[model samples]
Target: MTVSRALSKPELVSEETRNRIEQAVRELGYVPNLAASALVTRRSGVVGALITTITNPILATTIEILQQGLSKAGLHMLIGETRFSPEEETKMLRAFLGRQLDGLILAYGYHTPETLALLQAARIPVVELWDLPEGDEPRTPVGQVVGFSNWAAGAAAGQHLVDCGYQRPAFFGYEDARENLRWQGFRQAVVEGLGIEPLRYNTSAIPHIDDGVAVIERYVRGELEFDGAFFTNDMPAIGALFTCQRNGIDVPGELGICGFGDLPIARVASPALTSVRVPAELVANTTVELLTQQIKAEGVGAMLNDVGSELIARESTARRSS
Candidate 1:
């Protein structure tokens, strides 16, 4: 009991006893079996996180911050990449829950019924990142959402382009739920704010820079016509910029482009790409705070925390000089 208490809740143990325990631990080089400890305490001291992909810098940055926050709280983080596959995500979810994780964080909210059932059976606190569902409907498997509204972010991007005097704009992105929401928002904003219906093109489930190049190539071939374009994320936006340069299409002069997730490359591009900035650090901190509360058995309820996004305008979307 003394050893268990000392290892699990050190603050409750006396300094002398703790010192003795430490000395013994060092001499014995004994490692505590976390699985065994979890059986007694019902706390795993670990959190499981599932992200669509780590290749995206935005998601990568969020995970990094979240890991740091969890470490500061003396907790370990186990991460899994879903590769945007529901089957893979379900497998990872089961695997993590089998390990008795204290909580779970998911970058994507879309899950199958079986996955949802597994999460419910686990009864652990879950946080969904990246985007929240529209309306007041609580369709999420987990009640806690930590991230900005992709719809709002998309609307902001559209409004910025409209304000920059771009009438015929197009949207380029994947057909995923999150990207669909962004496209819907952008299209709605462009139609209402500018009184013009924007063209849209959806690529594969996994978006790549090559997708952007292809979209631009279509435009160059007169297959698509638009004065401005909004990419779901920076990867395609940057690619489109490169394609435009290669095709001798003057940015912001002949065509304006904007992207979501203000990645680092946005600023360094030849014509800096305008983008919507999702507050990754804020999202991570808030997710950790909410998860901590949940792990402590504090009822956070169905809280939807929108960290918000900012529209960053740059040379890519600059208005033509009068």
Candidate 2:
């Protein structure tokens, strides 16, 4: 009992006793069994985080920050990738829950009914990262959201293109709920604000640079026409830029290109790509803070933390002085 108390709650024990216990532990090389400790305390010191994909640099950076923050709080993070599939997400969630996780962080807000039921039954701290649902009454599987509006970010990019005097613009991205929201925002702004119906091309799924290249190739073949294009994410935008270069299209002069998620590569591209900077660190830190508060039984009810986004204009979309 004394050793367990000293190991679990060191502050409750006397310094001399704690030192003796620590010395004995060091001499014996005794590693405490976390599983046994958790069984007695009913608290697993483990948190589960699910993201759409681990391959994305922006999401990877966010998860890295989250892991660091949780580590400082004496919590371990187990990550799973869902690949934007609700069934896969639910399966991962069930597996994590089976392991007795103390909290959960999900990159996607949408959820299957089974997943929602499981989460509600678990009654653990849940945080949904990334964008929320569209419209004023946004519905989330969990009440906690730690991200900015994808629509607003998309709108800002669209507005910038319009302000730059691009009459004919298009939107390009993959078919995902998050990207769809961005596309809706971009299309709404371009059509409503400028009264110009922008062309849209939503690829099948998990669009790569080759997909972007193919779309631009189609445009070059006279199948599509646009003076500007707002890519939902940096990957496709960078790809489109490469396509334009190979086809001898003068960017910003002949075709203005804008991307979201102002990733590092965007800044170093041939013509520095214009992009929307999502607050990745802020979202990760805020998620940890909120989850910590919940774990401590603090009153943090249905929180929505919008860290906001920024539009970074670069050579790809920089307007020349007449």
Candidate 3:
């Protein structure tokens, strides 16, 4: 009884008794059966985090910070990569909810109806990261949001391009909803700034740096002559910049380039890519704070925080005169 109590709730045991128990545990290489303990306590020291994919460099820091924060709060994180498939996310969510979790964290607010229903049914703390509901919607369907505005970020990118005196700005991105929202924002800024309709490249391909090279090649061949372009991600933007350098296309002089997710490589690139910096650290820290509060029964209901985006204007989008 004393050892179990000490192991489960160390504060309840005397200092001397706890020290003795710890010494014995170390000698025996004792590891408590969390499953059995959970059966009795109804509390699992585990939280499940669902992301689109582990390979995305954009999410790497957020995931690292989230894991470290959760660990410090006496919780363990179980990560599941849904690979951008709603069906896969639904499957992972079902399994996590079925078994045990003190809380749940998702990479985005978008989900299938079944997934939405599952979130509604679950009693654990639910957190949505990376995106917020579209204009005027006060809260996400899940009613907990901690992210920046994709639309606004896109608009900022477009506006920056125009501000740099790029007459024609084209966009390159995937067909994802978030990408579409960004394009919409970008289009709004371009139309408002230059009174010209921006081009949205028609392609179903993922945002690879090679796509950027191909676009630049078209410009070199006179097939397309966009003075500026916005890539929904930094990879393609960097690719385009590199292509420009190799083809003798003057950056921010002949062309202006901007990207999303101001990755580490964005700054170190020869010309330094211009990008919208998503608040990964802020999002992760805020997520940890809210989820921990929810787990502790702190009555934190439906928190909606918009940690606005930061536009880092580097050499890629520097003024034409500069």
Please state the error at residue 310 of candidate 2 in Å. 1.3
Q: Where does candidate 3 stray beyond 4 Å? A: 11-20, 136-139, 202-206
- lDDT of each candidate versus the true structure: 0.87, 0.87, 0.87
**Which runs in model 2 stand beyond 4 Å of their true positions?**
9-31, 320-322
Tens-digit per-residue lDDT, 207-296, candidate 3: 578878988998899988689998887888888899999999998788999988899999899889899998889999999999999898
For candidate 2, give the lDDT: 0.87
**CA lDDT of 77 in candidate 3?**
93
Per-residue CA lDDT of candidate 2, range 171-220, in tens? 88877677777887888889876797898887646646776788789989
Candidate 1 residue-wise lDDT, 97-162, digit = tens: 989999999998889888999988888888999677773452554658977787888888888888
lDDT at 139, model 3: 37
TM-score order of candidates, top first = 3, 2, 1
